[model samples]
Target: MEKKKNLLLDIDEVFCFPGFLDAINEFLESNYVLDDFSDYYIDEAVIPQERFNEFNKFLDSRNLYENAQILPYAKEVLKELDFIYNIYPCSSCINPFNIIGSGRLFADKYNFLISTIPFIEPEHFIFTNAKYLFKADIQIDDRLSNLNENIETCILFPSYHNKTISNDELIKRGILRAGYDWRTGWLEVANILLDQSQIKDDKIKRYLKK
Candidate 1:
């Protein structure tokens, strides 16, 4: 049997559509004064520990875990790609303290993904600050900043954060490719990898066809 190619996938916006900032804004709109809170990505220290507790509790109450929706083409594409590559689900939760405030919290969240996403074993899930440690052949992630030039990386344009930056800018800067939103972007990734793999297969088939 041939060894499968390694493919790393990001969660959150990639598979599940939580609207990360949107959800937080909704929580703030209900309880806090939004007067001067223009920047959603505020430093973790800026938020009083009490307010952070409330936010975390709200997230857990909503059962954000169960509410996660698989991206439009994710399920189908994973089914096809599994035939050729080992699909590993990798994700990073900003500020480890946001969940349960320690390494244990990270472990619990990783376990949640393993239970939720079928075909994804707990061993394949990784929750870390440094994504490059995994050493995969390719990685598909939505955050452009996370792109590592050394690897074959695919930068996925996030739906909520469509800033002025273009995918071309990311590639020129060093990313392999930048795709549009998750739904269609994932399919394009699967096709591109498959096509590359097909080229090798085609060469072998040429002599047989003759």
Candidate 2:
């Protein structure tokens, strides 16, 4: 048997929508929008000091995560990916300033995953800002910084915030390899990783239950 490839999947923007950026604008009454996200760091990408502080407070809300909605095709595609890849729903719990949330966000994230994608067990879930530190064959994340060169295959997940970035610029920035941009929709990613294993593995429980 071939050793399975470990695929690290980012949770926030990829799995859910209106990500932190919109959440920021919604909670703080800031005018920041997706196009405003130019930097890898939100502080630089959107607002500075005061509003950034407010955003941090919003992250601490359990109700926010609990009420959050899943992105289009997220549940179905993830169920398919779960059948084929060693799916690890990785997320960043620690902030850029090395500040961790008050544990409420962590629980909220956990509960969200379990309730949303119940098939993804708690063991496969990872909460870490240092995603590069984790060993994986392929990684799918929304941030350019999150996709490290060390990962054998890095696929950047696109969202409203990152849609403006051109494929050429992504390659030029050294974030994505050549010929690897503009094809990261969930089903596209599913085909790239699972065409060879479309037949669900017998060991794990199947999603469709046919």
Where does candidate 1 stray beyond 4 Å? 19-53, 60-62, 94-108, 196-210
- Global lDDT scores for all candidate models: 0.59, 0.67
Question: Which tens-of-lDDT digit does each residue in 112-183 have in candidate 1?
Answer: 576666676667877777887777777777666665666665555344444445656875866644354445
Worst 10 residues of 2 by lDDT: 201-210
Residue pair clashes in candidate 2? none
Cα lDDT of model 2 by residue, 29-82, tens digit:
788754455555665555567666766766665345755657655677777677
TM-score (all chains, Cα) for each model:
0.68, 0.73
Candidate that would win on lDDT: 2
Model 2 spans with C-alpha error above 4 angstroms:
18-23, 28-48, 51-55, 58-62, 96-100, 164-184, 196-210
